[model samples]
Target chain A: MPHLDILKAAASSNQWMAIYPELLLGSLALVLLALEIILPKKQHAVIPSVAIIGQIGVLIWLAFNFHTVFLKPEHAYTFSGLLHHSEVGQFMRVFFLLASILVCVLGTIALAKQKMPRIEFFHIVLVVSAAMMLLAQSNNFILLFVALETVTVGFYILVSYFRTNPLSLEAGLKYLIMGALSSGLLLFGIVLLYGVAGNPTLPGSSANPMDFTALHTFLLANPNNFLASIGIVLVLSGVAFKIGAVPFQIWIPDVYQGAPTPVTAFLAVASKAAGFSLLLILTQNVFTPYEKLTTPVLAIMAAATILFGNLAALTQHNVKRLIGLSGVSHAGYLLIGVVAAGSQPLAIGAIYFYLFAYLLASFAVFGVMTHVAGGDDADQDLAHYSDLAKTHPFLGAVLAIGLGSLAGIPPLAGFMGKLLIFVAAFKAGLHVLLVVAIVGVVISIYYYFGWIKAAFFETWRAPLLEGETDLRPMCTPVGIMAGVALAMLALATVVLGCYQGAFGDWLLALKF
Target chain B: MADLIFYIFAAFTAGSALAVVLTKNTVAAALALLLCLVGVAGIFVLLDAFLLAALMVFVYAGAVVALFLFIVMLLDVQGGVRKPFKKATIVSSVFAFILLLLGLASFAHKGVQTTGDLGAAAPVGATLKSYGEQLFTTYLLPVQIVGFLLLIAMLGVIVLSKKFEGLEDIK
Candidate 1:
């Protein structure tokens, strides 16, 4: 029968080996759950270590096998065209793994203080990381939606893991509502595009329009199609919510302040990176025909995001909220790189470098926040950080370096990251956005410096009454694992800054 | 006949959807939502998407609405007094309203350009067999990934709700 033959052919193309990392991660997640059930209570502490080490193993294996299919002249369509694997996809897989390992490291410290289920947090992180890997390489919209939903649903539970905290619960509820709304918008856009592109009368329309290449061909044939343009804009808007761009950034501060610190870092770094990688793929490849519509929308959002993020971060005493808003500004800067990627190839590498810089600096800063945070996870404040350097020099130094890099200070990785993007933006003749980004960088320095000053230099305050006790949460002493992670992050930040080396060249030289 | 049925179901869905939003009583609103889903299923049937229509009715109208009713009844949630809109809310809503108008106007003007003859090629999700075959074959990866999604979601529910009898040990 033709049908049986067709099924056999399609089934034969399901290459499970191409996604070994994701498969290994999913298996590891299940193993963690099984171990939790089997191991006695005292031995449960080893579970987080397993998650971290297993992820590192995956990362090592990935690195060793990097050139197995790296920079192939053509993209590899695996799993029957559901995934389009390229060198960029490989890079993102590595990025997500690194981010997950750090989050797990921070999760141990953060979870130690909380009276919550610890094993589940690690399980969710692994599954979410695996999902993000698939999301980055999704060739079909079905896989994209499925992978994205897995990540988002994992976050909903992870966000509210500390259910004892009312703030955490509130953040979870807000995220659920807002996330559902964004997904609705994205689904509407996808349905619209799918409907429009499958119309047989349309030039270059495809039988399978959900595939990115198929949709790209349809879009190329109908560059000015109205429904297609609307769909593109709506999809971009949904992604904007994930990256915390202006107008879609209302949920950031509350969610950040209320979420446990490590999860906040995950949202700030990994989730944002996932969105940008998908955005890069979408705009650079699938949506290229709609550049006329996308470029202006992105440019405007970038400008607004930069101004809003910096301005809002000012006047925030809550350190988590402050970092969260600053992250918004970083998203703005990345948006500039994304817009410029249309005209400048260097912008792609610049964007990835910036994300790597962000991952390192953000995890460094958040690792410190995890140590500084006390029992009430939601109430971390800038005042609590006063005299931090005098008390704990290591954390204070890490904080200063992280913040300085974030502020684009020279000889720091963030400085190099920002410089590369600015150069690309200049080459793209986005002079207006370039100016907006500069002003944003200057404004961001003020708040970042404010944080640094709070840590390093003590400001005068009224003496406490005899009955009043100090409310500041005492900084937790660094553990061996956390210390190593933070030190590695800080060193990487400094080293990558001084020398981009062959790594930078490889990233710049990547095909889309 | 099909066009008439499509219009009727479409109207029914839209009207009940509006009721679901506007109604003050929680149970009444939920019932309206059920009607909305049924109407959507009806429209799906008119469009020759029998499997989707049945699944919509079965999964959403059957299971989900029942779950909603159980929760609503168990909580006995009263419709509290509505707060007045804040300045930001009002301003943003107004801006959103204008944008919606512009979007609707543009869609009305230009969305109808695609007047394609419906092709003989069968739609992917039109039947249970084809859907199952596709799910187990070409779309196997997504299906497996979705399994993980549900697994985590289940774990999340337990993590979020399970009472900690051994809190000390957990810590």
Candidate 2:
């Protein structure tokens, strides 16, 4: 009777504020859509500006209300446990907003160069960013599935935004098929888990079992249930597909190579962040009871992903494809955080820190790619980057720092992130994974440095065009804006690496 | 009598679903899909989910099947020709078989059940009302988010299909 009463009370209570950030972004998307219809095509530049402004506004709102989420424990479960408002969710919301702002800037630069519909591109980015924010707060299977699908479907359009490019279309088709298949697998897994949790024969089972806490209780009660194990593996496989882990990462290189550079950047950072957040949530909350069953699977996948991603990137000639392969290896490193999650308190913190560091470095590199490869898909070849320093010293420096961060070089955020992850794994006694990760890092340095060396040491040999005098002006307003964004990100990377102690402590203090 | 009706609908469902894949003519395949949807609706009625049955017939059979027919007719694809089966067919069939086995193994136990206490004893009318209540109250956020999803899809279709001013020369 008391349980029923509590359920009724929770259901009736209005906690709309828990979803305020999502609501703001969703409304902004609609507003942008309306403006797109009403405004003249000549005035389309305002759309990206408006999108960027809205994203910044959301970040400020998040900052103002951050304490409500972090300090108050009673506001955690809103919409009857559908959304969990916690410090981790708050942090991720800010992280996604930051990423969206950078992407909006990159998208604007890309849009100005290409002759595409500006409204749809910007508005869809807003919608997808909102979905990712909601994704970080989803505490139930229904919300998780819906939010994940929203992000995936939005990315499908963004990936193939260049409708005229056959390569982009091909990448879109591949992504759609694989995405649909993974969604089916994820849904099937949720159904199986729900069945086991809601089984009346099981003692202390709930009538409504999609909630994570309820599922956690059921899992703990029946830790060795055959059906649950299958469900866990299936769900993990779907997650692996999202994060571009080994076995399910076949689509990464093609999609990254074909997608618009800004979209590729979004996928590399924000989409991966969403996947890692969900994986962390699942491991810490629902799969803890079955840790004995799940950790080894994750460890093996992590090692294999690191090996495959790095080894394959050794031969890739395309810059985007190299980054794509390297992204797969980063997923492997993130998976180490997932494997050590059960035993190490700082594991999730390490994952988030690595993601933040990855975001800055990734966007900086992708931003340069966006400007450098303007209006030409053929310009992404690595050979084109020869003597970039001689032609564009500023961008050359940005690319070097970005690549260095990705390679986990010292005095950069990437190195600090990797150090935290390695320390966590070593503490958890994941010796084999730690060794494999170190080797993966070593292999990664070879390819990263290749790009750096090309930019710095190789000679520029391409003939100048009729109108181009000094390899084109790199000081236009758009160029200046992009340069400022990259410079800020590079500065943040160095600052975060130096201040890792304080940042990591703050992240680790948050309870899931 | 109910059992007899269930068997009839189930057989129709299986047969038409198979026909949907086996038949080469696109229009005929669309018609077969329509029949399969109707058969599934009939089965839903047998399970006493009257609301779901109506939705199945109206949405899937009426709207989606109509859309499929329109697309098939518009494309004017030449069909009824047997094409050589490729390696993809073999790979897909193997995966399909493995999925079938996994599904069967997961649901084979007598103790396995899909419905909980709330679904066990409800009459059709009461269940429908409660479903509405749940949808409006507990599931409101997902419902609204789905609205945004549809909006994004609409914008995507327009963006992909429309011919902008300067894009025609780029290809």
Candidate 3:
């Protein structure tokens, strides 16, 4: 009877205000659709600006009120324990919002070039980002799966938004299949964990086993349970697919190459960050008791992921594939941070810092790629950038800075990010992983510089046959909006690298 | 009698699942998947999870399999000729098979652990009213999120399939 009373009370007092940001985003998405229907054809161009400005408004509002609810010293359980809000969750909420704003900006630039229905793309992006915000804070399996699905399904559409290109459609199909398989694996793991945790005979068994705290208690009591270990591995495998670790990275190159540049960037940055966030929560909180098993598994995965990602990128001709593979190596480095977080509290901060650095650097590069890309978005190659610096010095500089940051060159945000992770790993005694990561970074530099070299220096080739003009698609001119966005990204990357400002200080001070 | 039914349904589900994978005809594979789902539903019924059984039949066996069949027939897929496995494919598949067998053997040997009898505990999803109450209360956020998921899925189908005309090259 008390349980019934509790349920009734929870139902009646579902505090909707705690998720005001998510609500605002979902409403903005709907408003875009409504505007698309009501407005005249010529006025539809204004809809994307509305979406972007509305998101910026939400971001500002969130920033102003960041400490209002869960910035307290402890975590707050809202939505009847479906959401666990903490400082990390708040940080990720802001991170996802910032990422989506950049995506919409890129979307506007990319969509303008293609003959596509533009409003739905922005709408889906808004909804997906909102879901990602929820996903970063989810405390229960049901909510986690639901929010993850929303993001994945939205990506399915965004990947194929450029449907005229066969490659885009192929990427969408591959993503759909791979996504479904990962979902199934994750669900299987969740079900197994639930069943085992709810067993009446088990010590510390929970009635509500899907709740992370309840499951954590059960896992704590049964540290060496066989079924729990299986579930843990399966869940990690599912997340591995999202972050593009070694064995699960087969779809990354193809999908990235085929997706429109903005969508590819979204996948490379936002989607991977979301995966790492989830992995961090699950490993550090729910399955922490099984570190005996998880540590070795993650260590092996990190080593292999770093090695494979670097080695594979060495031979790729396509720029998208190169970025995608390099993104895999980035995920590997973050995985090392996750492993280090088990012992070193600083690793969590390092992971967040790394993700932010990655976001700024990646958006800069992809922004440049978007302007440089022609009608056929999937056909960008290094050869197309033979004389990029000569033609567009502005874009070429942004590209260099972005690639430099990604390669962990000094005086860039990415270097500080990598240094933080390596320090965390060294403190945690993950010496072997640190060595592999350093080697990966060294290998990574060759390819990253190859891309830089492609832009800044022309490779000598046989003279073009008479009358065979260059067949490469003409690079689109950068708009004022895109130019400003790229400049902001490059500037932020440089600034964050040079100074551990208040933002960096706050991130480093965060605890799990 | 209940034990007999459980064994029968398990066999039926396993056999049909194998058929779904091995069958060459696309339509036959779809039908086999339906049977496999029905078998799962029957097993759920045996476990006193009537609500789950009903939902499985209604959702997966009823709607999803039907959609699969419709798409299969509408496309008039010849099921495509199967290509011979390459040397690498064969080697990798064999390796995977061995790994799978090892996993199954370990699971069979050590996966099951004894638990106290469950006769006293209330089954969470055994009835409709309680399930609805749970969905509206503690699980409300997930339900709303699922709403968005379905909405986007519907929008995805439309945006991906719809044809546009006289589109300008914006470049």
lDDT, model 1, position A165: 98
Residues A440-498 of candidate 3: C-alpha lDDT, one tens digit per residue = 99999999999999999978866889998878777778888788889999999999999
Clashing pairs in 3: none
lDDT of 2 by residue, A1-512 (tens): 87576457656654777778878988898889888679866675677788888888889988888878523777678887888877888899999989888988988887766677777788898899999998998889999999999999999999999877787888888899999999998988898888788777776577678899899989988877878888898998898899999899999999988888889999999999999999989988888999988898999999999999999999998899999999999999999988987899888788888999999999988877776774565248776677678878888888888999999999899998999889989999999999999999999999999999887896656788788675432322436667789999988888887776776789866557
Model 3 chain A — which ten-residue stretch has the worst lDDT?
A68-77
Per-candidate DockQ vs. reference: 0.81, 0.38, 0.66
Q: Each candidate's lDDT (Cα)?
A: 0.93, 0.85, 0.92
Clashing pairs in 2: none
lDDT of 2 at A131: 94
Model 2, residue A453: C-alpha shift (Å): 1.4
Cα error, candidate 2, residue A493 (Å): 1.0
The window of 10 residues in a row where model 1 chain B has the poorest summed lDDT is B113-122
Q: How much of the true A–B contact set does each candidate keep? A: 0.91, 0.40, 0.78
lDDT tens readout by residue for model 1, A1-512? 99889888987788788889999999999999999999999999999999999999999999999865524545388787899888899999999999999999999999989888899999999999999999999988999999999999999998888899999999999999999999999999999899899888889999899999999999999998989998998889888889999889999999999899999999999999999999998999899999999999999999999999999999899999999999999999999999999999999999999999999999999999999999999999999899999999999999998998899998999999999999999999999999899999999999999999999997987899999988889899999999999999999989998999999999888769
> What would the C-alpha RMSD of candidate 1 be, to one decimal place?
1.5
Candidate numbers sorted by lDDT from highest down: 1, 3, 2
- Candidate 3, superposed: residue stretches over 4 Å from native: A1-8, A73-75, A461-468, B166-171
